[model samples]
Target: MAAPKPGHRRVLAAPIGLALTVSLAFLPGTASAAPQNVALQTSDGPQLSYVVNTKADAATIERVKKAAATAGGTIVVAYEKIGVLVVHSANTNFPQQMRTIKGVQSAGATRTAPLQAAVTTEIGAPEYLAGSPAATATDVPGAEPLEADQWDLRAIGADRAAKINPGSSNVTVAVIDTGVDDTHPDLAPNFSKSQSANCVGGVADTSEGAWRPYDPASDYHGTHVAGSIAAARNGIGISGVAPGVKISAIKVSDPETSLFYPESVVCAFMFAADHGVEITNNSYYIDPWLYNCLDDPDQKAIVDAVNRASLYAQSKGTLHVASAGNANHNLAAASITDDTSPDDTAPVVRTINPRECWDIPAQLPGIVTVSATGVQNIKSYYSNYGRNVVDVAAPGGDKYQIPDTPSKNGRILSTMPNNGYAFLQGTSMAGPHAAGVAALLKSTHPAATPEMLQELLKEQADNPGCPTGLYDPDGNGVADSVCEGPKPVNGFYGFGIVNALDAVTAP
Candidate 1:
């Protein structure tokens, strides 16, 4: 793939910041507004919103105290936390106003939209082939030679951890995608029922529920992604990056259509953050909108919410990783400018390359955005690149046809839903490899914060065949020589390709 052309940074044109304010006054008839709350996304944690109370003022407090004295109702839950207040009333019909509430200017519920399911097709069992391998020669006492017909799990770093007893049994990685097939023989053993949820359209048994665990639906994308993250390594057709790590399958996408809405993504992020998932993998992206300022009123509010949620997860040390995008455009490029006049003269010229830019949630700050690379450690022909936006790259595979050479086909081989296997390609396939590696690093370094883990991974990456003297115009380059360029991190290959052993043992 060619390097992205230089383009100007275009900030998104939207209002994203505005403080929320609320006002409340007592009214007749005690009907309530169904517990108004706002899901706030913070930089330091997951989602948190305020619970409004109509009787929080000094006068109301006094009245409540008197009412409790008279009614023998004492406040059990304390609202001592600043900006947090609660009210209790015996009048089921107690009339309360919700017009004014501090820190809560509006009452809106946030939910994750539906995610599209991944398509699945059978690729058959592995066939041992006589060819050069990516890793050093090692012997599995009783294991059979890997089948060539099977997907190449080892090339993408899954086999390394598998050799060391699969993964740490205690760790569970969250796969927040379309629902998964929990009954698959290769995946059932490592799936955790307590940590799974099908958040698709808030429905049960319908099309949305088909992706839920034990459901007879074919929503296999999450299963595939999860299998790649931690498929059971019990002498099966394939192994996962963290074979022993239990999987928390959170189905947020649709099983039939591969489509997902933004709200669902937000909900999924919050769910993972709130849960004890040490690592969350997002292999999807939204179309890129030109630079929207970090403080646009609406954008800022949404981003602030997301950042707050991420911050909350980080507080507990959860790592969030996503795919940079498949579009081969510079992430920092300016929006397309139309030069043609009114329709009478000539046609208007709009930008032809939409996928050229990095998509949202991935482009969101603080999240790891990964790109894809092919065999021989070169960038994948369809993989996107941006020194400023993409944080790293991994072996996602390629499909190049070389004359008389059995066509060098590239596809990421990993576990799928049901008792089957599959070959997937795309940055989607690459992101999970990185996520699994991050999980391994987290398991190895229990005390490290998410931020620390990210830094460590970059610091321990291994540089392969990157070019020298290819300066990034953005001035983000830290090293001058390709070999010496910023030893641990850079825009392209964010710290270079991940080194499993180095990341697992980093000081």
Candidate 2:
């Protein structure tokens, strides 16, 4: 499938009257309450996942168990209505049979997969570029400087007051994406102390001794994303959003092929959540095949699991930041209605009528859904927006002009894969930038809860594209009026482009 293109459009449709419901099965298991922290039931039982479709009942449970048994495994979790079952394979050979079982559906490796071999061909390391040591280093050839770097570190400052702080040693941010180039001089110093299993699969080669716990694959997406968050700022290459921060690389997606299963992604999340990591950044979005409300039961189950894991992370005081999605249509407005029309799977293209909304994961209550903005202080042409859905916007590079070009402003610069640098334009890139900013805030304000961190980020946001007075035409105060011209908290630029300095300094 082609990569999802970026663009935002108003979604005009009726509200989804159905409320998200959860069903209780067996007494809440350890995994159920803390989906992301999966403690092996017996140290031998397959890892448990707490996220299950509560709508599933006893009958559904029996059906899933029977299917798993036939496939030579046991059902760890059963999600009836959503059609998802977490099965632990007693043996590895039954993987194929497990897929064939009636309700078994797709399966992921119960054990960790190895990373792909690293590139044998040696390439000269790029010249290191010096950046301001006081703030985040922005050395990308054409990348714009972050306005937020000027402020004191929010989370870090808070931590200092409490006397419990992350001095270079305790702060770690996990970049769960394609994979990282451990050998990259710019990223090597900050690699985690111990490596973990690759949820995706295969062993990664570390020819230059920079190998960490992440799996290796052709995909450079994870590596690039990692660089942006915590690439080493040792006076070489470009600096990261949080230069003082360390990086934990977890390869969940293949950047080269963009091929990744939902199960692998979930496992990666669980791994990060269980381990003592401060934050996890996810740049990927939901697949169209699985986004349908009435799609395959297993697909729905996986989506539910992802949400569960996210909640679990939050309960641990660890934030799980995800991309709002590239689709321009309002997620709430777009849904799988009972209509049997032929074009049901077709993309939703309609203008939002007065007083309607749609969005996903972003719409998911607790998750932080970030939007994108360009240099001109306007919303990125590809950014999706809804007054209530998008929590905030950050600098996503613009395609119209060269980096630093007077008229062609708004592109954010950070490290790219292969020791090279390029201005990536998309919410995918924008989300991480904000995540990095959040990491910085978290470092400063150790006592701030995830909710508090989010609130501070919004309150300190610089309003743009709207008037100074109440711009919310909807009266909800959630959706600001676009007519007032973009302001810090207006619809076009949620809370105004992220002001790193203000976020850190705000009391």
List candidate 2 stretches off by more than 4 Å: 5-67, 71-169, 193-197, 201-218, 254-257, 288-290, 294-299, 330-363, 401-410, 466-489
Q: Residue 268 in candidate 1 has what lDDT?
A: 57
Q: How far is candidate 2 from the true structure (C-alpha RMSD, Å)?
A: 11.0
Query: Candidate 1's residue-wise lDDT over 418-459, tens digit each?
Result: 465655566766677778788777778777778787776667
Model 1 TM: 0.63
Tens-place lDDT per residue, model 2, 255-326, is 333444444555555666667777776666533231322222333344454545555566677676656554
**TM-score (C-alpha, index-matched) for candidate 2:** 0.63
Model-by-model lDDT, in order?
0.48, 0.47
lDDT of 2 at 306: 51
**Span of 10 residues, lowest total lDDT, candidate 1:** 1-10
